[model samples]
Target chain A: MLKFTEDHEWVRVEGEIGTVGISDYAQEQLGDVVFVELPDIGKTIAKGDEAAVVESVKAASEVYAPVEGEVTQVNEALNDNPGLINSDAQGDGWFLKIKVTDASQLEALMDEAAYKAYVEGLG
Target chain B: MSQDHDVQDLKRTPLHGLHLSLGGKMVPFAGYDMPVQYPSGILKEHLHTRDAAGLFDVSHMGQAALVGPDVAAALETLVPGDIQALGHGRMRYTQLTNEAGGILDDLMVTKLADDRLWLVVNAACKVNDFALIEGALDGRASLERAEDRALLALQGPKAADVLSRLAPDAATLPFMTMAELDVAGTPALVSRSGYTGEDGYEISVAADDAEDLAKLLLAQDAVAPIGLGARDSLRLEAGLCLYGHDIDEATTPVEAALVWSISKRRRAEGGFPGAETIQRQLADGPQRRRVGIRPDGKAPAREGTPIMKDGQAIGTVTSGGFGPTVSGPVAMGYVETAHAAADTEIDLEVRGKALPGRTAKLPFVPQRYYRG
Candidate 1:
């Protein structure tokens, strides 16, 4: 299942492995993703903490962690192809894959339906 | 309510509503609420100008006049440009400098008449610039703030032909010239200079006439109203400096690669502030020089990104972005004199990872300023 943060990061959990990246709305807002600063593979991050940074031509933004976890893998392809976030934000654009340490942390994130409402309210 | 109040506090241009209606993403820039980009995005808006024409609302820039019996002499006290030689309706790009030869602000000054000097300065530095000019020319020149005026720029390869329709005489003015003309029945002060490296016209009119003038200009099929987002990218591609970013109070004209703005006559006369230090820097080349940077890959080395040579930090990027016209990443920075040469190898530390970079020639995309 997918969960989201008010800051626009999205998390997809499958067993204990969770994929995280910015949501489609965030990608659109960022316009073109020119650079992505990925965290090291073994870095530990807390829920709602700034884990990475994304830069477009006109502005820069911080990509926050959706939940507490240890980064097990990062999307290295983003180094040369950051635009994938704009073209396929949810799938190929996943920033990092984390080994979820606490499942209860997911309870704080908004689900797909709630996330949609949250984004709508923002507009 | 506090959040709403904060939003309202963001300064807005006269055309803010029109921008939002056209799907512009509002952003704070130089204390003004401005559009970052429209639905077409910065890249598209940038490319469109290189291919065609882009209309830009630069009304937020500071416009004012110096009126006095000997305005040129009074103005010369503040800047290094040869203001006395400026014929009527001629413009020169000049910099306001401090005692240590550092640039306070770079601006354009035009002689509209024997006793009138029209000036346009960067929005962010206007307050300080006004006070400086006012203080320097206290007795000789009277300052008239044009807070009620709006400035619009129409720039590109087709800018002249399109704008000629509104004011037929405007097409004949050469680069760096100005004239008062009528556009679509509205009187405006038109200058044949622009920030984009394209042939263009900057039209100055009353604030109330802005929307009407902008709408009329947009009615042309080739003209599109671009926002601040595209403006930065376009100027970057043109190798132009953004005051606070590319050049600041800490930088001098020689160091910023803007020595051309200091005329031969001004260099010899040496009457302006900081002339001693500026002339010395002119005689002896500056210690650090600004050079264009071409990062080898897509990862852009943005402003404040450290630049290194042989694993030793040397400088920092001043302005960096993806050049739509160049089809790659482009940046400008101050590097040590030895490393500022073209094709010299360097590395940029972006988020702690050193990306290989090279010293490249400026105007990463070739400039097409109309000489004729």
Candidate 2:
């Protein structure tokens, strides 16, 4: 199941590993992600940590980690086609796959309904 | 109790709701509700203008008129430009200078009639400009605030062809010329002028007719409503200066590299404010100058990035971003005049790291202005 962090990154967990990217709402705000500077593979990150830098034409933003884990893979294709994140943020735009260091971190994420409500409240 | 009521408070244009519906990330800009970009994104929007056409809602800019028995003389006293020499139906770009030779604001001035001068100024600086102009005129001329006016710019390569259908005469108005016309049956003032380096036109109409004008323009196959995001990139690509970021009161026209706006007559006569100081700078050359900077790598150096020479901080980046046309990072900054020459090696302090950069000629992307 997909879960969302307050920072707007989305994660889909399976066993002790998960794929992470930004929510559609976050991608829409960033406006045409031109470049994505990814975290190196095998790098460790804590929950809510700034994982990568995403630059748009007008401004730059930091994409944060949803849960503590070791980066196993990064979407290298994003270097050439960052617009993939703007077009299909939740699926193909996944930034990286992580090997969860602690499974309990997933429990802190919000479910779909909670995230939907949270985003609505933002408006 | 409505969140939108807050948006309405800060001057909403006709397309405010449309921007929200398009999922435009709304932000406050120049005391107005504006869309920085839509879902297709800023980069795409930026590239779209370079590739096709981008419609810009620039209604936030202040539109006023200096009307008097001797409007040209009154305007001349405030700005250094030779207002009298500007032929009727033509516009000139110039700066309002302070006594210290500092730029109060850079603006566009047009001779609409024998006794009227049309003025467009920075939205944020309009109030101050009005007061300053009024004070400078000292009742010699009257400043008429055209608050009921709306301004829109259709910019890009296809702009002229797209706008020609509205007023066939617009197609012939040569750059810097303005004329009254009926666009889509609504009376408007169309000018062959724009901030984008691309060939484009700016239309001024009654505020009440803005929605109809915008819809009619958008209905054309070549038009797309651009937001503030593309505006910044387009202007940057043109090597145009943004008021607060690139040119400010602290910087003179010479330092900002806008000495070209000073007319030969004004340069010789020296009757305008800051005449002595500006003349001195014009003759001796400025100590620091604005120049284009191209980073050696893909990392973009943005505003406030410290410029370095020999590993020491020398100046700062004014505006920087990814140039879609160049397919690389480009920037503009102020460096010591010695280092301002093209091909000079420099460094930009980006993200706490010194990135290799080179001084280069401006308009990193060649400007495609249609002078003919």
Whole-model lDDT values for every prediction: 0.89, 0.86
- Write down the C-alpha DockQ for each prediction: 0.45, 0.44
Candidate 1 displacement at residue B258 in angstroms: 0.8
lDDT of 2 by residue, B134-213 (tens): 88887688899999988989988988888888877777778988999888688998888898788888999998898778
For model 2, the superposed segments whose C-alpha errors exceed 4 Å read: B1-5, B14-25
The sequence of per-residue lDDT tens digits that candidate 2 reaches over residues A78-99 is 9888889988999889899999
**If you superpose only chain B onto the true chain B, what TM-score does each candidate give?**
0.97, 0.96
Candidate 1 residue lDDT tens string, B1-372: 001224566777777777888888777778888888888888889888888899898888999999999999889988999999999899999999998878899999999999999999999999999998998888999999999999999999989888999899988888999999999899999999999898899999998898888888888989887888888888998999999999888998889999888889999888988899888988988889999999998777789999999999888899997877887788999999878999999999987789998999888877787787
Q: Model 1: per-residue lDDT, tens digit, A19-53? A: 99988988998897777888988999988787889
Best candidate, lDDT: 1
